[model samples]
Target: MTAAPTHASLDPSGFESRHFGIDDIFYSRTDGRGIILAANAVFQRVSVYDWSDLIGAPHNVIRHPDMPRGVFHLMWSILGDGKPFCGYIKNKAEDGSHYWVLAVACPLEDGFLSVRIKPGTEMFRQAQQIYTDLRHRERNENLPPEASSDALLQAFESAGYSDYASFMTKALTEETKHRDIALQRPADWRLRSILSIKEGVKEIEDHAGDVVRIFKQTNQIPYNMRLQAGRLEGTDGPISVISNNHRQMTQSLADAVATFSEKSLLGNDYLIQAEFLHGVSRVQHDLLQSFGLEPVIDGQDKAQEKALLSRQQMEFVSMAHKAVVEVSDRVSAFSKICNDVRRLKAGLEMTRVMCKIERSRIAERVDGLDEIVQQLGKAQTDLDHLLSKMDGAVQQILEAAERLTQSRQRAA
Candidate 1:
């Protein structure tokens, strides 16, 4: 085993970001003492190091200076208990270029096997910020790695994560969902048609949240309109008729908005299921690749075992694709509802504008009519804003769906 580098011996200068392709997966095995024992071709390529340089070096040889020492301390503590650790890691290459990976390390027969892939999720970005803060504390406060680890845990807790494991699991799951769709290749096109679907789900989730907010605001619109209608209850002619019609329109709009909220919630639930399935598929893919099964089997039992595993993987892939299809269907429905809401909002705005014009004609006769008109106008403005946001989100979903269809056609 190689000796671990002392903190003072590690350099932290002259490095730039080095990006690897999304499909690249790096694998390495480390001794119990944290010395690199072996690495795959992808690992060598990304690290810009020869096999000779890596094989006997301490695993931390690739550790980037920007990474918090606290993270490593926590990893070692977990590994000591024979538990696997998963995290977003920033690593340095031999040529002083850095890259980020979502890495999982598990105890193997004699040591540990680690597999890593590019991270492409919002949580990864959050993790990066957290790491930067922890690194800053370690340097500025002259804190030891162990002390920084405590701070790191506190930060995670403050961010609403129950523990490090919870945070890592959620982050990894989300990243996997995004990468599954975005990183599909012609040779290994598992979930190939789902490109950008994860992003679309995120968009829909955001839109749903906006819908909930708009519903709350629109819910009040009818109540206010009813109050105004009561003020004009004793009036005669088209004015009274218009007031009644306005109240009716507002109530109908409110009901439509409520229905939209319900549909968005349902769509969001389906998306969560899709994300879970994608995460499982990613784990299966990584496990299959890490095993590095031989193409030419020499024994009957080994061939049988391989075939069984392949069949299982195929089943998993099919299930994951089905989940993606379900998500696409839900998002399509959700997008259609959003479009209807946009048109409904436009109609509401047109009616409100006509009401204002009529109120202007009787400005001297109606004391509070202007105030009512102003309130309705404000409500219309809020609805328009919400609908605009939803439209953008729906467009994103449609574009992703189109891309998925195109990919399938190409594959066929």
Candidate 2:
């Protein structure tokens, strides 16, 4: 590995770069280990490097010194696994000029494809400051790239990013939003839907946490009934049998609820994966719409480039569509779960009805018997209320995923 560049070595005093318009997008395709394979005209223009110097060259030929080694370490770690990565990157030109871009890197069959836009958002400034601080720390503490990468993630957590996945998606979404405003363009609905899906999935995950508590509360009804049964009559009486049956049914229902919670969590992961690919497709689609249509020396090269770019974008889009469908199926599973829970709720209602009947039949008075029946009534009421809300949320998610799926199909 190249020795980590020190802050002094990467000082901005030497930065001399050309500014590209916010509309300008830089594109490059590189091999697995960062060897450059192809590039767009804008990238060639900004880097001040010809096709001869860029093609087959290590991508680091343009890597800005001011960029902390930690960023690249984190970047390659994700990209190495054929995953997509989005972050702000500063690149150096052949004559040492520098320009910053919000870059999205996606893994390709042969290597990786990067699409970058000039960042107009305030987040770009934040990224610059973060990189400077990390580079300074690396120089002062003799930190390795991996250690500096850990520090960078800690810095992100301090800045309100829960993890790298959330941070990357939010950052890309922010940059895209700012770009639209800067260009005086309408909002990109594609990217907006991706964020909305992510938020919806998070809501589902939060609600899943309550399943255990809700199911556990119902267990108390049987226990309370059994206690009262012992006082009202000898053990193994009619009330005792009813309580035992309630326990068995509720136990099975509890197991089903547990599975629902697990599926909710798994669905949340699918949302993240879908959002990541959607973001990938968004940037590549931009390039396809603008870059491929522009003039190139030979129209054939442009066609070929657009074809490959479209293929990659569609590949992600296809996977994202599948994920959205999977999320929909998970929602359907939740519907079934809610139905199962409803059956248990019905059972509780019946048990309460039986208790009331028994109270009327008894000539001798029993203390707290009415209250236990009321408690059973309350549990059923709560379960009904919870199921209604959960079903509503599930419906909303299903509708949102359907819309998102339709958009993906159109984009494909």
Candidate 3:
């Protein structure tokens, strides 16, 4: 086995000579024994100590109090065996401010190579929970605080993370996709408004899948959309669109449902379809409301609109049927007038014949009656023709009603 490199023997002020010109990151190489063999200028800056002060010191000099030592112990186990290891780590800075990093560290024959990046918020939160638990165990067991790192590793293992590498992979992967970034309005709406709403729902479902995938990767607390209330504070986020648009769709569907007429069987079937649509709206509205958005349909407006629409539809149908009845009555009235004129004509004709044996004055009266009868005949014919056209109109209305009923039944 290769022996660990000796610590860099140098004066504090001469750090620039021993470790110089590394990249912007804090760079360091530590031997098998944890001795710092080399450090770049950035490392000196981060450690809050000059090169001379840091060179011979253990690499643990910058370790923050909140970091579990067991993580390092496990990290070393893999690296000491010439393997790569990665983890989320907390590192203290010269200014006492701490930063979280997702660290990838490797072991070489001579020393170790480490690289890191900023950790995600969710990762930091989970790490905090784990480290806190480790701290409690350390206190209860009276073990050295650093020894709690073992407890953390055990906890992670118990939770089924195969190793530090796997855990880090999951954490990094979880942070990769932002749910809202993947959302897009669906295409192929086919000019159907309802289909468009359905497409939006599909997009939301896809986003929800992303959320679930992230949770599987991290084992962290998954997002609860119902609980995310402040998502609209900025430019509208995905959740904001969902909440607002969903409410709008709900109100629209409710209004459409209310427009169905109650008297027509076909209209009633349309109402049933509307009810199904309304159910979808209700569920969506409830979800959005849970996230603190105002619903598009208020309680009173929904109730009043539904009742008013039903009443209006019934009134409209009743008025149409009443019109049919009024036309029939007009026909009957015209017939009665014709019948009275006919009777008068018959009486006048008889009187005129009898006048042949009497005066010509009675014959003149019969002539006047004949003219009245002629006008009544013309008027009766016109009225009858108008009544016949009205009957045809009534037939058309009934046919329309039948067709509408069939269509609604199919839709239902």
Candidate 4:
């Protein structure tokens, strides 16, 4: 039988220098206008560039040819804005060998401060392969350079999605599962679960606010257009062009609802979710215009409780934010509980399997206490679903916020 791999086995530290692992630091250099000044031994070993050869070359020289141009383009964009940036990068060595690095690069007094850790996890490795393939395809098509992060997302939708939100939802779900998902019991699982659900809903609401901010900041496609054209030719058109793609609207309301369900299961407070939500809603609003489906906020009710509802919603948002901060404080506590529960269940399952393996078919009735464990799993699933529903409802509130913003803008 194959043995379970140890953490050390899964992660190699051979790249460490005499003092630290190779992954401890990939490179430590100062560059002048993207040209390298000095590099560490580990950097030379992994990048396959000799100290002499790397000292004068552009940083892009080590950028893997297969890596997506969009990422580098984004990095440059950040630098132009005088902002530090970080991302997962795949760099090629002098010998054509590839390595993955979780890299952070930022401008310094003279040049830049760059730090990287070698990452060989399956998630990053697979992403590297995917990026490489995408790059190759771009080369063959002779299309502009490559898609912008947003445009790449649009490409996913253009292949078939009503908006970027649906695409991002699907992508995030896939990414989460690829990374590995685990659940646990709560000391106050029920209460914490409820709080978590509220937080998830609030996160959706917050994302809406962010989307509005982004739209306000960059409504003109001209700037992004120039970036897209310079890199990904032919994709510099208005948002209308991509939003109107027939394939983009293939995703239905039902699909969006399901995405909310899956995403709400783990946690919330996504950094990019507002962007995704804004993108999706934009598509939906555009489609409604095209198809002549009257867009409605569904707020026609004139009950006296309207004021109360508004106040309650605001209170909920505030309370949810507080809960989110608390959850962050005790982050991973719930997951640890889940890990304990999972381990216990696995132990029980092993006993049952061993019995079958040995042909000892006597089922030991541990029902007296075993029932509780089973109940916990069911509770976990139910909590997950509840969190999901809350997320959807909260997302609706975000939609309302968006509408409110648009209305105010029009009035102004």
1-412: candidate 1 lDDT, tens digit per residue: 3233323313456454564777677667677788986655678778998777888899989988788888988988887787567788888998888888888776654787677888878777677777777787788899898998899899999888878876776776666667667856332333333435656566666766765675465445545555555666545544566656656665667766777777775354444444444454466466557446434322224444344444544554555555656766776787678766776666657656766777766635764666656665776677677667666766666666566556545744
lDDT of 4 by residue, 108-185 (tens): 556765656544444344444445555655566654544545444454455565653343344433332332222121
Candidates' C-alpha lDDT: 0.66, 0.78, 0.43, 0.42
Per-model tally of clashing residue pairs: 0, 1, 2, 11
Best by TM-score: 2
* Clash pairs detected, candidate 1: none
Measured with C-alpha atoms, the lDDT of residue 69 in candidate 3 is 61
- Candidate 3, residue 269: how far the Cα is off, in Å: 58
**Residue-level lDDT for 124 in candidate 4:** 49
lDDT of 2: 0.78
TM-score preference between candidates 2 and 3, better one: 2
Give TM-scores for every candidate, taking all chains together and pairing residue i with residue i. Answer: 0.51, 0.85, 0.35, 0.36
Worst ten in a row by lDDT for model 3: 260-269
Local lDDT at 362 for model 1: 61
- State the TM-score for model 1: 0.51
| Candidate 4: regions farther than 4 A off | 1-23, 146-151, 155-412
224-300 per-residue lDDT for model 2 (tens digits):
88888888887887788878888888877777777776776746667777777777777788888878656684323
